[model samples]
Target: MDTIEWQDFERVELRVGTIISAEPNVKARKPAYVLQVDLGEFGVKTSSAQITAHYSAESLVGKQVLCVCNFAAKSIAGVRSEVLVTGVYDDENRVVLASFEHPLPNGSRLA
Candidate 1:
């Protein structure tokens, strides 16, 4: 694995954001959802997450999750994904999101 200094890692804008809304991305070839996350001062950002195996549109709302906000917006599955919703793959290869059990300020940086 590539090693980096703490400052280098800190440059990545990993923040906490709450899922404001989610919907099925029908245009996607594989199953996916288009999510809108409220990032406090950063405002609402969008992402396309392939987490259908463990999540639903209804369940995602109001959930807080880690996000990488510095990446440029890109088109994914017909949606303009603005931020990366960080997650880890499970044994089944399904994505399980990195989430917080306690509420944090939106856009709170992960130190």
Candidate 2:
């Protein structure tokens, strides 16, 4: 991987957000969900996550997950994805969310 300076890393706005709501994104070719995340000061943002393999809509609500907030919005599966919900892949190639065990204020920045 290419090494980046501290400033470069700082440019990526990695923050914690709470999932306010989630639902299936029917327009996606692959199974996915449209999520509404509360980013506190950043307000609520939307994301399209391909996490249906490991999580359901009911399981995602109220979950606190990390996200990249500065990314430009893009159209995904007929929805506007405003932020990138971060996750790591499991051995089964399913996405496991990067979440917190305890509650945090919405839009908490990751240092």
Candidate 3:
């Protein structure tokens, strides 16, 4: 694995956000959801996520997730994805979101 300096890692804008809304991204070739997350001072951001294998739109609401906030925005499945909702690929090749057990203030930086 490539090693990165602490500063390099710190430069990544990883923050916490709460899922305020979620809906199916019907335009996507693969099943996905368009999510609106509340990032406190950073404001609300949207993301197109393929996490339907393990999550439902109803189950996703109020869930706090970690996100890469600094990445450039991209249009995914007809949605303007503004942030990267971080997750890991499970054995089934489904995305399992990176989540926190404890409640955190929105926009809290991941250290």
Candidate 4:
């Protein structure tokens, strides 16, 4: 794996956000959800996430998740994805979200 300097890691805007809303991204070719996350000072940002294999829209609301917040927005399946909701691939190649164990203030940086 490539090694990154501490500064490089710090440049990444890893922040906490709560899922205010989640719904099916019907425009997506593969199954996906359109999420609206409240990031405190950052306000609400949208993300198009392919996590339906393990999560449901009802199960995702109010969930606290880590996000890569600074990447430029990309258009995905008709939605403008703002932040990237972080997750890892499971053994079956389905995305399992990175979540906090306790409630955190929205927009808190990951240190």
TM-score of 3: 0.98
Query: What TM-score do all the candidates reach, one by one?
Result: 0.97, 0.97, 0.98, 0.99
lDDT of each: 0.96, 0.96, 0.97, 0.98
Flag regions of model 3 displaced more than 4 Å.
Answer: none
lDDT of 4 at 45: 99
Off by over 4 Å in 2: none
Residue-level lDDT of model 4, residues 1-111, one tens digit each, is 999999999999999999999999999999999999999999999999999999999999999999999999999999999999999999999999999999999999999
Which ten residues in a row are the worst by lDDT in model 3?
A: 2-11
Q: What residue pairs are clashing in model 1?
A: none
Instruction: Specify the poorest-scoring 10-residue window by lDDT in model 4.
Output: 99-108
Distance (Å) between predicted and true CA of 63, model 2?
0.1
Among these predictions, the greatest lDDT belongs to 4
Cα displacement (angstroms), candidate 4, residue 47, comes to 0.3
lDDT of 2 by residue, 47-97 (tens): 999999888899999999999999999999799999999999999999999
**Model 4 TM-score (2 dp):** 0.99
Candidate 1 per-residue lDDT, tens place, 1-111, comes to 999998899889999999999999999999999999999999999999998999989999999999999998999978999999999999999999999989999999998
**lDDT tens digits, residues 1-111, model 3?**
999999999899999999999999999999999999999999999999999999999999999999999999999988999999999999999999999999999999998
Worst 10 residues of 1 by lDDT: 2-11
